[model samples]
Target: MNAHDARGSTQLLTRLFDATPSDAELQEALKAAREEYRVLRWWKLGQPAVDAIKVKLDIPQERAGSVLTELVQLHSDKLQVTVNAFPYGLPALDGVLVDVTMERQVTG
Candidate 1:
């Protein structure tokens, strides 16, 4: 995905992918992207579905699935994904849940 930054703050995903980013840098990007996803209502708990995290991250669709898998693995304790309860709605991804239960403690 040749995605430009929605905020125009240098394309995050594309640049990060093209370079040799440190794990910390990559984690930071993922964290930012995850927050953006939540704010956009794509990461809601009971919501029907959401655009894939890769879409929000501007990750190429070709690699989006893999990237998402990586994200789940890296944040295994904090993230989880399951099928959408209402396929009539999103029919794709609605189960991309984040453990906000501990968010305040971690980021507070």
Candidate 2:
């Protein structure tokens, strides 16, 4: 498989292996991640338009818009950081890796 395909496959497997959290916990995590993303975007991009945020995340513009909406609903508070996706190789599968970036918010 090509590098891109391998990475995507690896990501899918990783998602499957990660321990599943309760719905409430998952919601909380998503909320926190969204808030962190917004604060960082505002600081770095100056309250960028929705389309811009999507481009930065490498996700669809519509998804980015949805994320922005959710962020607004959850927390008006702002923080600074960037979320990036990277390629990680699969532990068991040979020549397979997935694109996944760590969700990190830069804080002083």
Candidate 3:
């Protein structure tokens, strides 16, 4: 999907969860999903899905950003990456909302 379509899908899915999940909670969920996807696919560590799957998992903004930065540095030679987070809801400690995605470019 195009960037706009992908973003729309992320937002739609994020709504399925609680109106707001903390950054830590979102990161843990995304990390879990990515690990599952990787094991199922038997893919290498730095594949495109490594990042996109993280996004598809729906992580929070700050944690996702931190995780993506660490991943990028750790796998700099194997992956090229882009990360995005869509924040929703009011900016508050209890009601803050965010959707995060990390995109890894695939090269032949």
Q: Pick the candidate with the highest TM-score.
A: 3
Cα-based lDDT at residue 28, candidate 2: 93
* lDDT of all predictions: 0.36, 0.35, 0.41
lDDT tens per residue, model 2, 1-108: 543444432333233324344668768976866654323222112222211122233333334445544434432123222333332235632221112222223346
Tell me the tens digit of each residue's lDDT in model 3 across 47-95. Answer: 3222343332344444555545554563333334444434444563322
What digit string (tens of lDDT, one per residue) describes model 1 on residues 56-85? Answer: 233433444554555454333333333221
Error of 1 at 74 (Å): 1.9
Q: How do all the candidates rank in terms of TM-score, highest first?
A: 3, 2, 1
List TM-scores for all candidates, in order.
0.24, 0.24, 0.30
Candidate 2 global lDDT? 0.35
> What is the Cα-based lDDT of residue 9 in candidate 1?
23
Where in model 2 is the C-alpha error above 4 Å?
1-17, 38-108
What lDDT score is found at residue 42 in candidate 1? 34
Residue-pair clashes, model 3 = 0
- Top candidate on lDDT is 3
* Native-referenced Cα lDDT, model 3: 0.41
